[model samples]
Target: MLKINLQKKLQRFTLELDLEIKPAFTALFGPSGAGKTTSLNLLAGLTKPDSGKLSLKQKQFYSEKQKINIKPQQRNLGYIFQESRLFPHMTVKQNIEFGFQLLTPNSRKFSFDEIIETTGIVSLLERSPAALSGGEKQRVALARALLASPDYLLMDEPLASLDQPTRLSFLIFLKSIYQKFNLPILYVTHDIASVINFADEVLILKEGKIVGYDKPMRLLAQLQTRPLAAGEDITNIFKLEIIRQSKSRGITVVKSDKLEFVLPHLDLETGGELLLNIPASEIILGITEPNGLSASNILPGIIENIYHLQERVLVEVNAGEKFTVEIVEATVERLNLKKGTPVYLIIKASSFRRLS
Candidate 1:
């Protein structure tokens, strides 16, 4: 377990947060200048706090009252920044082994061969950082960090620089490592999609303070109340398994426990699982079925919660897990939507956004 109750004052902003993370992936999510990077620096011992306590399990890394502060090198943390930070002249293999050579004999935890295999960087070992592509360079950087045999890993928007396709692949790779190694990860990112698919718990930061910390879905449902970028809206993510394929239209039939949806032209094998994102504003709610409707999908669900905004009401429906639907105030009264009231959710086939 990792516990932090720290406070630090910077030139422009002050950082204050109290969070306890278990042996799982925890995400620090917020807008720019929200102090997510500063928190990571404090954990890595790259920045010193004015006062507070920090501990990992039984080890105390910092304590202002006790007058104890550990150096960055003494913390044994694997750090991966937005840039690869690889040596320009060194080959990939050399860069990875450089850290392994500095580990003490008794402290050596991971082997070079294991790191290479785990990160799938064997083919790029002979290539220099300059010869590698963006994704390949980041893979080598990950291998180097893992080779250090750290107790925890700190990732500060490592995929922020990659293109869309590369970023998607890297996110999947990161999830695999998190599941296989069970390493405590402190991931800092501003992307909500990344947080939804990867993070177990989310810590929302605003102007140097932690505004909220809870499970990803719960925190995401409250996004309207928080400050977000323009054109950024709430997303409802669902875990689905492919049931069949429509050969004519080249679409995949996906089903969750309680709802079914069709996605455009997928190559997934039968029974393969995937994540789907449905935008809240794209959903339509109706108390009774409309005649001659053109929508392809309709789901029956009950209203679990309703959140009133400036002009819209975000209604959470209890489907398989939970899905959100945005509706207007006039519709809310016309439908007589109340907690525990059953209604039909109409969604167009094109409304579903397929994510890995």
Candidate 2:
């Protein structure tokens, strides 16, 4: 278990953390300046807290009262930042070996071949960092981190620079790494979509305080009742079974327990499952169904609840499954939508992204 009870006085707010983390995938989610990164820094020994205690598996990393502070190198943690931060002048292999070379033979846990093969960077070992793509550089960074054989992993928006598809692919690989290594991960991000199905537990931070902690769906359900932070994107995730496929029509039909929708052509077998992502902002709520529409997905349901943000509103509709839709205030008033009102959700086929 990883325990943290720390306080740091920043210029704008006093960061306070009181949490226990198990050996699983835990996400630290918040908007910008919410102190997500600060918390990671404190745990990694990069920043000192004003006062508190930090420990992992009963090993004391920091103790203000005891006057004990461990150096970053001695903490045995793998920290991956948004940037790959690889040495540009060195080859990928050399960069990855930099840390491993420092460790004595007794301290090494994984062989170089095993780490490179697991990270899928064996072929790119001889290439320089300048020659690697964004994904490739991140792969090398991950390989380098794994070579050190840290007790736990700290990721600070590691997938922020990648595109949506790349992010999805990298996350899939990260999940495999997590399962294979059995290492606890502290993933920090401002984007909720990245942690929907990936995080075992999510910690919501606001103004340098731990505001909420729960599973992804529970926290997301609770978040619908209040206003979201600035630039926060609420992404809905669903794993639906494939009903049929039409290659000539360029579409695939999928169904949940209560709703069936058409998505763009996916080269997957029928009856197999595919994970889908649809952002709240991408959905449009209609009072009634209309004809001659381009979008193929039109789900009808009753508005179970409504929340008013500053300029936008989030409406929860129960259409076989719960969906949180975002719309402007004017649209809500023009439609005269309220609790128990019937509404149609319109979504474009192109708006859906496959997670797996």
User: Which candidate should be chosen as best, given lDDT against the real structure?
Assistant: 2
In model 1, state the lDDT of residue 47. Answer: 91
User: Highest TM-score, which number?
Assistant: 1
Candidate 1 — what's its lDDT?
Answer: 0.81
Score each candidate by Cα lDDT: 0.81, 0.86
Residue 72: error of model 1 in Å? 2.5
lDDT of 2 at 268: 90
Q: Write the per-residue lDDT of candidate 1 for residues 201-263, one digit (tens) a residue.
A: 888888998888877766765765643345556667666899999778767888988767877
TM-score for all models, in order of appearance:
0.76, 0.70
Kindly provide the TM-score of model 1 when superposed on the true structure, using C-alpha atoms.
0.76
Candidate 2, residue 323: lDDT: 87
Find the number of clashing residue pairs for candidate 2.
Answer: 0
Residue pairs of candidate 1 with colliding backbone atoms:
none
